[model samples]
Target chain A: MQTTDISAAQQAMADESVKRLAMICWSNDLDKVWPTLILATTGAASGLEVDVFFTFWGLRVLQKNNKRFTGKNWMQKGESFVDRGGTDHLKLGKIHFAGMGTWMIRKLAKQYKVASPTELLEMALECGVRLHPCQMTMDLYGLSPEDFIDGLQPTLGAASFIDMAAKADITLFI
Target chain B: MAYPQDAAVQPPALRIDALGKKCPLPIIMLAQRIGEVPIGNVIEVLADDPATKTDVPAWCGLKSHEFVGAGELAPAPGWAFRIRRSY
Candidate 1:
């Protein structure tokens, strides 16, 4: 009867459910950020529905990347001037050595033909990795949508991230 | 009949040359290009990075593609893997 077609469609739906990966990027350090993008990109490429929630200092990676420093006031400017938001400006979490370690890592990544963080992020976006910026972090930093790179989902709260992660097969906080 | 692999097989419809590249890079290239070929058609992936051996097949398994096999396809300093797209 008519039930057959409906059941067939349901079977098709059940057979095609995609795996999900939920990642919370909590640090801005280049070392940590590398793994985040690597996993996100790999998961997406492997047909996983991938979501990256950028929170706290990690939200800085979503900013409009460039060499110039940013800030509107004394404290903000001081912090940004000291540590920038772009991928190249991000220092290693340990053994930063006042930028020497940063340069060496970038250099090694290039020599090895490993894509830079910016390139990997772009690739992740290309492969359909959803990028969500934490609303609380954005507001705390006084950042607006204009401050970020293109292709970011509208800012959402931690509860929303929790809802996503609840359904995710793999959840990582980095 | 089981034939010797890579024995006068038809050239793959798509060839992803990822030589001199690093880990996920080669696999990413494979993912991006695998769609260019029709289902059942093979794709040739040339990669020097050691990680390619595992990553490509792992991706193939996850995506339901078929991993044919790998061998030396020279000037690349690495092996060439033949992958058949299943869907």
Candidate 2:
């Protein structure tokens, strides 16, 4: 009975029904987030089931961002408010030079005909890639449902993401 | 390997111009438009980005489509890939 069960389990593992990609987005910097979206879009384009969980600083990418403060409390507001930027206004991880490198990178991407991070994020949505916001992070940052762009999968916790990732053919953290 | 015939044998039903698009955009365009053509028909993708060489074929294999062939653009830079809709 044990040998039979082992063979059956191996068969089930071999016969995967879904080519899924689960990615963890842990940083909000443009350079980091850009590749994450690019991979998400590419996986979707290739017909994989793609999920991206935005957590920690990465939640900034999903926020309805502007110059105004965003948190409910003083510490949250003071720390995360001015740093909040959506896909269009992300800061570079290195050589930012007070936004000059960010500007240059955007221009360079345009000149090379490479899609901007914003465009890639939109493409990820258009391709039906499932976007999941981290619930704990949302609470910590005092964000609400309306803060994100439309067409997202419901919020997921780290445990929920791990459950999904266990069944995925590929998992990435970016 | 000898290519089945030439461009005459497998004329494309549609031509997607992704001349300036980079990386995954070309593949995204191909994926979005592959359904537009009938099964067994060919779609020619014109891409200037060097990555197209591997991406087009990889996408074809990943999606179970048929990669017909590729050719240089001659006076223009880059290459064109002919893909047939297998399913």
Candidate 3:
């Protein structure tokens, strides 16, 4: 009986479905975006169904224009000025010398032949990784679906994301 | 352990030199080029990225390819991964 149970368990393991990787991206800093894209692309490349949920500051990356602040308040305007631009314009977390550090990182990445965040995103999309924006955050910021890059899945709520995460083989918060 | 001499005689059908390339690039290059070799034939990937140590095997597992083994490339700073196309 024990042997039969062991073999049944092995059969179940063998019959398991394809692996899934779900990630919650809550930060949009240059440093964070690099890892997020790298992992997403790599995960997809490695045969996992990769889904990245962009929320809060992380949604800034999916915006059509990185420099524009949609908010009406002065603080929002100030944040837009400081965080101007999309993936290419993101600032480093530390030693950000008036955008010089971001420039230097880009230059070094080019020199080393590393894929930039933009390129990684493109590759991830090509690899069939799903990109989802958080609807709650979008509504909070008054952002519509048209404001995001093309091919994004419909904006999802946290509960929907949780459902996806519950079934994923791996879940990450970035 | 000693293997049959015939096992050592077969050379890789394709070799990818990914030295100096960073993570994802090496893997991307391998993914693109693995198709160039015939199925069941072996392809050797030379990569310097530390991540490739795990990444290559993970890719093989995901793609249903065989991860034969990895060995150091003598006189150079990198690894040579041997993968057999399973399908």
Candidate 4:
């Protein structure tokens, strides 16, 4: 009789087997941030267990104190989606010329029927996309836990991220 | 060359050339092609660019395609990715 090891290996190779994905997105550029969200959400929707750890400036996206949308790094001249009623609360101090860019994006989305970042954020949460704010980066940036948007997971450290990656079938940095 | 007249009856093998394309395009193309192929068929993507090494497998992880590994091809100057459509 054949050993069951072969059967176990075969089962391991089966298509329906679950795959965990670890995605690290460290860029704070608003444009870059969305792709990570879209990709991570898409991954979760497609059945891959997904974890996204935001570090450095990337943590700004989840800051409750910084609820207003910001533009991409290079362009620096547009409104983020937050100004278009994407989120319920808007941080007052950060509001500036970038607000117009957010309006433009909303107008474009209305014209093109594209999903707004706010809509995407809702979808991401619904789809079980685990969002991790980095503890080290948060501390380095002088952001307290209260600064993060409500309902997001607490910040994680490098070792925990590595362990998550080790269990993941695939890991990505974007 | 144009697609064969009976292409619908005989599913066309997908060839995604994602060399030099950045970010989501590579992943997007891969996702699109996976849907086009029939289950159990093979799709070959030629991506010489380095990003696909990470992007392609990541896409596979999401879309349920089998990432059968990538390696240097017989002909130089690019890499080949083999994916088996499972969904």
Best by DockQ: 1
Once fitted onto the true fold, the runs of candidate 4 whose alpha carbons sit more than 4 angstroms away are A1-16, A65-106, B1-87
* A149-168: candidate 4 lDDT, tens digit per residue: 55677679999999999989
Q: For model 3, what is the alpha-carbon lDDT of residue A101? A: 86
Q: Give per-model TM-scores.
A: 0.91, 0.91, 0.81, 0.49
lDDT of 2 by residue, B1-87 (tens): 223585548678999999999998999999999999999899999999999999999999888898888888878897889999998
Summing lDDT over every window of 10 consecutive residues in candidate 3 chain A, give the lowest-scoring window: A64-73
DockQ per model, Cα: 0.83, 0.82, 0.65, 0.10
lDDT of 1 at A89: 67
Give the C-alpha miss distance for residue A84 in model 1, angstroms: 0.7
Give the clashing pairs for model 2.
Answer: none
- Ranked by TM-score from best down, the candidates are 1, 2, 3, 4
TM-score of 4: 0.49
Q: Name every residue pair that clashes in candidate 3.
A: A66-A85, A67-A85
Point out where model 3 deviates above 4 Å.
Answer: A1-15, A65-79, B1-8
Q: Which ten residues in a row are the worst by lDDT in model 1 chain B?
A: B1-10
Better of 3 and 4 by DockQ: 3
Residue A12 accuracy (lDDT) in model 2:
86
User: On lDDT, who's better, 1 or 3?
Assistant: 1
Worst 10 residues of 2 chain A by lDDT: A63-72
TM-score of 1: 0.91
Better candidate number, 3 or 4, judged by TM-score: 3
A-chain TM-score, model 3: 0.83
